[model samples]
Target: KTSLVVSYTTNGYPTEYIPTAFDNFSAVVSVDGKPVRLQLCDTAGQDEFDKLRPLCYTNTDIFLLCFSVVSPSSFQNVSEKWVPEIRCHCPKAPIILVGTQSDLREDVKVLIELDKCKEKPVSEEAAKLCAEEVKAASYIECSALTQKNLKEVFDAAIVAGIQYSDTQQQPKKSKSRTPDKMKNLSKSWWKKYCCFV
Candidate 1:
């Protein structure tokens, strides 16, 4: 997620692995002389953050449910972990199923490693099928390293967020919670990370 936002906003790929626990980035682009803002929320996918992550979903307009194409476990999590979680929190929000790291699908070293594990790269057809099962609005495969289909991912996010906002429920003020788990969460949290272009 950080890579996606950083690549688009900075036009540079991170040289090393630097995980983000949580961060929000904002970008404003002038479209036809009108300024449009986009927010990209980078949330940790670790199991420890599962409870805290829902706090970011209260008013989410759309979800980009992403999984690495070369990781079978990640792909499995799309249906087993992600789709269910998002449905519970944002039932009406649109979802765009994303297969990340398409560039690695053909890497010999990666393929050999996966072969040892008796696994293969996820096929586009299978990804699309999963999208249908989850009722996702769209499915796209992209490689941030190569910038392949990267712009389409964000473009789809903007379009779907805008369209969903028109028909979806107004952002309901989430009930104030006082638990320590909720202490660091900001109101309008989703807005801090994402906006329609």
Candidate 2:
């Protein structure tokens, strides 16, 4: 089973602009199958995140904490608050940090500067540091608009989640599939032919 939780914040705060939205987070249970569960949570700030916690804890194999690369505040919120909150409940879950909206860096920079003047600066470097501190399995930049690195981000997250799961799984008994198995068979002409073959 696989699952995902995505959150976003738009506008800013106090003034209350429209909350940012998210594309569906999807997963395939098999190699050539449609996703069993593709959930989207389009909400603002901590409220949406709080609503997502239970779903994440219950269903998700990987938690992708995504923030707009353009919006420093979004990254800051994840690193400083959201990630910790999620960890408290799902500490073992693998986290994949996604820096979204990479295509809108210029516009985002302007917004960031404005926020900075208003004493609400967003720092990309700071966000990266925070991701490192929290031991993110991977960090990637993506753009939903252009679909840049979208697959890469999710693929990395899935890979990290699978690796983490494999590490946690109990070792199973080894199944013999070697010369020993062949030797255990009857030493008939057929067996010899099979062995040589």
Candidate 3:
């Protein structure tokens, strides 16, 4: 998860593994020719931070529920742990299931290590199936190291966030305003939309 966030924000992989409690990044991206500010929160998934993680989910518009494709245990944790926790806190937020580390899924060294433990990389089909089971908005596989499908993951997240925000605000719209006026999103949009992963 740290690798994904660091690579996306910095355009380079970290030299070493540094445990993070929680970190956030902001980026200005163009979606449909409009500037959108995205606040991405990289929350810790370790058991130690379990008590503190939910504090960040309160106002989240979308979630990127990520698991490593090369690690079966991490994939298991997606369903066994992360999804339930996110749902408990932000039931209405959209979730995009992400399979990270796609570049290492076929690495010889990693495969050998996994073979020793009688495990294999999580297949794309299984991840998609899990996404359906958990009612995720979408499923995407990406490699932070090689930067494959990295942009697509965030792009999908942005679209999902905007769509979810639209749904939440639909009921509050005045009858005088037509549906076409919805495109006039507030300039202070960053204050309302935050994505967690």
Candidate 4:
């Protein structure tokens, strides 16, 4: 997850991997020549953090629901664990299913290990089906190591998020004219009377 965040934010491959249970990274991306501040929240998949993780879901515009393609169990968790958890907290938020570690999909070492366990890399077709099952807004396959389709993944995310936000944005309430009784009040008198703020 950090790899996804680091690669997108900095555009340089991140090394010396370190894991943080709950981390937030901020990045500004240009969408149509306007800067959109994006906050990427990375959460640990450990069982203990599950209880505390959903607190961040409130008012979230979009979610990147990621799974490792080479690890079938992780893919399973997308349905069994992640999607349900996100839906419970932020039901209406748009979700983009992300297939991570695409670089490892065909690596000999990774394939042999999966074969030992009688497992195979999750296929793109199956992943797309899973995305549809979860009603995801989009499905993206990307490799953080090689930076393949990495930018596109985030671009899709930001675009979906922006669209979601636009629909959810409450229409502005026009300001009413000040009451006649309050209109003539002196500035100093008003400040002294309403200084509670």
Candidate 5:
């Protein structure tokens, strides 16, 4: 099972101050004593996504969609566009919603002013709503720097993948034979006949 972390951006430019965000995304999960492969990409909006959609469609089992809780716009972009596009390409893929920089709330506030020249407050309620709308299998508030809640994120993803894999392996049941068929196939035919006699 392959895992991909998807993030969207306007143009090919990385969302202004997300370099640290990338660095902190080092969450790890192991399957059957083997480490799972993880991929990170910036969809770069519709144009870039169009080019990458085919690749994702053919590959990828789980997607961890991350956005900053501080930036409502980023959350909106993923909710309105990225999530749907990824779902369309990989319908069966399990998705985990992650809110990054849980330890850097102070830094997030500073960056918001520096990058956008405006102050926007982070809202936990809004993040929860976004997570719900996207049908996120699990939601994690994490910090890549401190590694807080990072393990939980990967753990949840791995559990979800395993559960999904197990579900797919379950054998399908066929329709049961009718009463007449059961009677004919009974193992105690001689006993029934002797009893009757």
Candidate 6:
């Protein structure tokens, strides 16, 4: 996840790994001819941070639930853990299921490592099927190192986030919009938030 964020924001991979408990990054991009502030909250994914992670989910418009394509265990955790936790907290928010490390899926070294453990890289078909089972808004395979499909991943998130935000602001009543509703919409429309888990 760190590599993915760094690559997208900086167009290069991190030189070294640094453990993070919680961190946030922001980038402004023009989506549909309108400037959208993409606020990304990179939360800790370790088991020790499990109790504290959900606190960041509040008011999240969208989520990027990612796993390494070369790590089958991580892929399994997407359905067994991540999706359930996200659904419990933000049921209405859209999720873009991401399979990261795409560039390593066929690397000879990586394949040899997995073969020794009797495991194989998570296939794209399997990932898409899991997305369907989890009802994800969309599924994408990307390589931070190669910068492959990285832009499309965030593009999907922004589009989905905006759509979700619009739905939230829609008036509940069948009657015409009132002045109070318009005021609330104007005040909150500019605020868009997304989280990386």
Candidate whose TM-score is highest: 6
Q: What's every prediction's RMSD, in angstroms?
A: 7.2, 13.4, 3.3, 9.5, 15.7, 1.9
Error of 6 at 118 (Å): 0.5
Report the error of model 1 at residue 118, Å: 0.4
Better of 1 and 4 by lDDT: 4
Ranking by TM-score: 6, 3, 4, 1, 5, 2
Taking the tens digit of each residue's C-alpha lDDT, what string does model 4 give over 1-197?
Answer: 77888887788778788865877778776778866778777877888877888776765778888889999999999989998888887788888899999999999999999999999999999999999999998899999889998998888878888777766653354254356534542221211000000
Most lDDT-accurate candidate: 6
lDDT of each: 0.76, 0.51, 0.85, 0.78, 0.53, 0.91
* Model 1: residues with Cα > 4 Å off, grouped in runs: 30-33, 169-197
Model 2 per-residue lDDT tens digits across residues 96-121: 77777666665766666766767333
Q: In model 3, what are the clashing residue pairs, if there are any? A: none
lDDT per residue, candidate 5, 52-71, as tens digits? 44453343445667777566
Compose the digit string of candidate 3's lDDT tens values, residues 1-197.
88888888789998899987898888888877878888888888789988998988976888999999998999898889989998898888999999999999889999999999999999999999999999999999999899999999888888889888777666464776765564554544543355455
Report backbone clashes per prediction: 1, 1, 0, 0, 0, 0
TM-score of each: 0.84, 0.59, 0.90, 0.86, 0.61, 0.93
| Candidate 3 ranges beyond 4 A from true positions | 171-185, 190-194
5-89: candidate 1 lDDT, tens digit per residue: 6777787787878876777678775534555567677778899888887777765677888888999999999899888888887
Which pairs clash in model 1?
Answer: 39-193
Pitting candidate 2 against candidate 6, the one with the higher TM-score is 6
Query: What is candidate 6's TM-score against the reference?
Result: 0.93
